[model samples]
Target: NFEGTFNTGAYASWGPTVANRVPVHASGPYFIENYRAKSYAVHTNTPSSGAFRGFGVPQSAIAQETAFDLLADKVGIDRLEFRIRNALQNGLPTATGQIFEKGVGIKECLEAIQPHWARANAEARAFNAKANGSVIRKGVGLGSCWYGCGNTSLPNPSTIRFGIKADGTIVLHQGAMDIGQGSNTVITQIAADGLRVPVHSIKLIDGDTDLTPDCGKTSASRQTFVTGKAAQLAGEALRRQILRKANVSEAASLEFSDGLIKAYEGDTSVEIELTRLEPNAFGYVFMAEETYDPPVKALDEKGQGMPYAVYGYGAQLMELSVDTKLGTIKLDRITTAHDVGKAINPMLVEGQIEGGVAQGIGLALMEDYLPGRTENLHDYLIPTFGDMPEFVNLIIEVEDAEGPYGAKGLGEHVLIPTAPAILNALRDATGVIVAALPATPDKVMAALMAHNEE
Candidate 1:
């Protein structure tokens, strides 16, 4: 028989303890169950809760994924198999009672990771069965969670402008920022392909509010899909305008390439330079602009809504070692699989995954907030070079029709499953379970002590 248990946690929002109302926020109530107990951010004399790298997914994964490893050990099931059996699919209902509309790849992700997981799990098990002779036990664990690709319940939109200059160059203007994730490059690619122009012929003016359209913030992985589409539509519109102004026949299609507009059936072609395409310039012809808006709704008191326009999924496996005495954890290797719908840039997607895993490692063994306070990054520690582990980044490309070229956002999906995976491995190695974030030496030691006492 197939079986699984799902748990969730919530954050309580009391507007400062002095406020005379019960905090009805979903977060406080949501995480307590996942934490195997309750945790409250009582309207303290301090600050409130907010989103970070992994959002609510990280908090939830940290608890349930740890529990998953414990459950796997008890059932004697392969960890990977355990995950696949319970992996959320497209039609599955989420804990919040919402059905996924499209682009769910939780199963696909598990399938992609099967081979690597088998090999890694074998190595971890073999080493644990017979290796260093000590109280220290080496194990492997995993963590995974689901979240929509962009801002949920928040207004998400993008606008872009495309114009052809007198010199035949294509100019694209957008409000998206690069921030190191290649947003600018991808937007240019979409415009070039749409206008039929050489990639290099497109000049992108982006992230300047005064010079570009309102493309929304760069936080969510929405730029490439949302803003990129706007750029493409604008380019297509400009292409139509050019043909209309040139009085070309319907059959006189124009091929856009290398900044040149050529009559499809004739030797006539004109190279347009972006500088010469200024609206104030003589003979400057076509201009087009467009905006994109996806349907979304607000959740009522139930803490539900079309929070995400689209969702991205992933699965991961970890091979790790825990020194029972030293109370230190070592991550030997990690195999991560994600469904990105389309990898506009495979390298870029890999980068996003790798970076996210780094953050995950931090959450599992290094990152921590000072007790009773969320402020001060200086006081809050995150993983550094000492924590980097071997990573097997796997990109499971499943074309998402709503995304650009079938590409969905890969930004936040990578980190969700890592901590749990590692924690599970730890349980496998030592037959002991630690339930909390940053399973530090002190915490692990405490668990070991408690186990020995038992």
Candidate 2:
């Protein structure tokens, strides 16, 4: 039973976008039959609010996760076990009634963190017990989240084109923007596997509208799932053409190297010289263009439908020390489990998870934007190098039938559970529930005083 209203203010007249998403995501990634939420973008004098990392899920999660923590305490259930009992699984319907036949990994993510959660809880209890009336107290908290991969049940498609040149070189027209998120590397890896060639043989030309097809924008965590699938299909299509030209069976093993293509089947082999092959209409030995769109059903009047083809699940645990007298929180460690369906590149996935955790820390403790008072970087602070804590990232691989090579998006999913986890840990340490965000020292002190009075 939650209700919300989003005020985009003056820009609501011109930028009335994402107004539909606030309510849709306010349900917070669980199965709720009688849930209802209302959101509106009203005109005001203040600046308009725009899209950020998790669309509206992070804001919704703050409310839902806080409530879940209270509910777990009320029901006398371990927080982790309570989440596991209600964790989404395959064949279950979401709040929007979207039924997923596979790729539901929330339960797996929760289960993966069981050992870490137990150990951390025990350590925190021991440390707190030893403090014995000291101002410093230690606590551990957990948060779980689920994020839709692409646009909610809308036709957001990606197109990719690739060609094999006369010199046996592979050129991939990757239209997805990297923006330092490693789309260039991840999509290239998928293409290389699809074409069955060494990764070194591929050359990438990305984010150039004139040279590449429309792979869509690099938002909504869609590049990895949508563009990757397009690249995979294009690579497979080019491979098929190459196989046909070599006069080899589909089961035959093919190798490309040194300006030559070789296909082998049993004791028989066929070699095709790159110099002798005829170029196609695109002036290449083989070329392919493919498009991929995650299947989704349109929302009806009630804003319920198949919103996303796949979702990424994650759970994070935070261990921290809170100083009651000084009203300061120091993070010691973070344990995270992410269900990415498959890790196309382990390094990239870990980097994303770590980066997301940093952002989450900032949002939880320091970063707050006020138009007049905090207009610049100095006034609007963020986490520094000294603010980072020890990190332990766990990768959970639950095969996704619709993903490229059984892989899903991990960009936005990394941070969804972070802020809530930190806030919950603060509550555990000080017994103070922060209703507002960025629980600064002053706010924490105020909340502590209020709780003490109560």
Candidate 3:
């Protein structure tokens, strides 16, 4: 059973949305015989609780995973081993009763990190065994996450438009904002692949209302899956039009250059002059606008349905040392294994993982919101580059049938496991469980004192 109460402040902003989303994700990616989840939005006299990276799921995961640690200890099973055994596999239904026949990769992620978990724990034990009269103790812990790719049983759709001008220059009017998540690069790559053209040959336009279509808002890690699918469809539509005009077979190869198109299939070649053709009212000889709404079904009163068509899965292992006296944690390493369906851009995925890990550090050790009392940057701390540890990334791919080129969402999944992993590591170093956000030095010291007294 899972229950959550959120202090959605004065305005209540996205409280209802979050209230609905948390319960659906509260189950994580594990299988249970039965579970009931309820969420309450309590009015508070604090700042407005707006949307963050993981919505309310991160907080729910922190509570759930921390509880799992206690359960694992009580059952005499290693924490990582316990999760792997219980990790949701293919054909296992979710809390919503949505059973995926394929594209379920939580168990794969947990298994992928097994070697890393072994190494981290071995190093920690060896270091702790030799720590005689030392104030520092090493510990390692694991955390896993599974995130649905879109909104919770809502009508969220993405539309993309692309057209070839008389000069043969392709202008892709995409509405999905980049927001530093590499949507521009990812969407363009998908579009290019679908259109059978070079990425650089196509021009991308975003945030321009007059030129771009409504590609939906940039959240829930939906751009790569939703908007990208739309872009792929649009590109295919435009390619089909060109093929029809040339009277070429579907197997024909395409070549797009300035003011012309060349279609070749075995000895049959067809050329279309772009400059000679009449332009449409949108000022393009050929254009395609396609919309893709991820298949979803509204949950019943019991919150059961296909809330999201695709989901991302991940596991992470963190190794750190806790200064028993100072209650400070020094990071040593972190290994993250995630099933992204497919990586459209490997470097961007790595950047996302590293950035998410940094945010996870803040959520685990700092970045506490104190409402009225905490007004300045000094009051709220964040992690910097100097705070990062040795990072290892393991990209897992379990292709989704609905995704474009077998690509799923990666933005939110990377951060969900971070905070819990850090807290679990802290618990390993000092037999104290911190389910709360931002385990500050004072809180750590207090928990340590309690452990010592016990």
Q: What is the C-alpha RMSD of each candidate to the true structure, in Å?
A: 6.0, 1.5, 1.1
- Candidate 3 structure quality by residue, lDDT tens digits, 194-224: 8988899989898888889998888998999
lDDT by residue for model 1 (1-454), tens: 1121222113334222111111111221112222112223333333444445655456556666666656665799876677777766566555344566567677788788788767776776677678657665667666665556665566788998887665565678888988888888888888776766777877777778888889987765678778877877877777777766565654456655544566653665444333444464323357788987756676556544566566677778787778888788887788888888877678888888888888888887867765566577777778787787887888887777577667677777677778778777777777667776788899888988888899
- Candidate 2 shows a clash count of 1
Q: Provide TM-scores for the models.
A: 0.81, 0.97, 0.98
Candidate 3: pairs in clash: none
Candidate structures ordered by lDDT, highest first:
3, 2, 1
- Model 2: which residue pairs collide? 153-307
lDDT of the candidates, in the order given: 0.67, 0.86, 0.89
The model with the greatest TM-score is: 3
lDDT of 3: 0.89
Q: Runs in model 1 with CA error above 4 Å?
A: 1-42, 47-50, 72-76, 92-102, 243-260, 265-284, 301-305, 371-379
Best by lDDT: 3
- TM-score order, best first, reads 3, 2, 1
**Which should have the higher lDDT, number 1 or number 2?**
2
Q: Which ten residues in a row have the lowest lDDT in candidate 3?
A: 433-442
